[model samples]
Target: MSVSLMDFHADWCGPCKTQDPILDELKNDWGDRFDLEKVNVDEEQDVANEYQVRSLPTLIVENDDGVVERFVGVTQREDIEDALERAGA
Candidate 1:
């Protein structure tokens, strides 16, 4: 099962900044277990729109089956890990 984590954020968003380190740590620890992509909403409005992102820090967990989980605002590391696990990562 393929899993992808999309982090939708903006450079100027404070909450988004807070979420960055957690994601980086996860990326490092998870290694090749899952794919991670950080999408800056300010620069990638189209991508944000496609995902229907309405919050500064939106996390989308997707698997081969499609989107499995979506989170808005500052999400915790545990919560993300749980979502990723559920997505078969």
Candidate 2:
């Protein structure tokens, strides 16, 4: 199975704000191949701290067993697609 994409973000963060549309587009394109879960770091401080999320727009790719990779910032489509492939999407 493909790894789920966990998106850590905060509404107050500029880059995170910019990532919303991109994520929406990706969800539509990738379909069931990738699962995207958006988490608001500010609203969910415990999750942020637990996940060790130190930056905005953090993308954590976790497979059925565990995490495969972690990406920080607004990720590009190509990069994300590559990551998905690596995660065995």
Residue pairs in candidate 2 whose N, alpha carbon or C atoms collide under 3 angstroms = none
Candidate 1 residues 1-89, lDDT tens each? 99999999877899988999999999999999999988988888999999999988999999999999999999999999999999988
Q: Which candidate number maximizes TM-score?
A: 1
8-79 per-residue lDDT for model 2 (tens digits)? 988688998787888889889888988888898878899889889998889988888787888899888778
Each prediction's TM-score versus the true structure: 0.96, 0.89
Q: Alpha carbon lDDT of residue 42, candidate 1? A: 84
Candidate 2, after superposition: displacement of residue 40 in Å? 0.5
- Report RMSD for candidate 1: 0.7
Compared with the true structure, model 1 gives a TM-score of 0.96
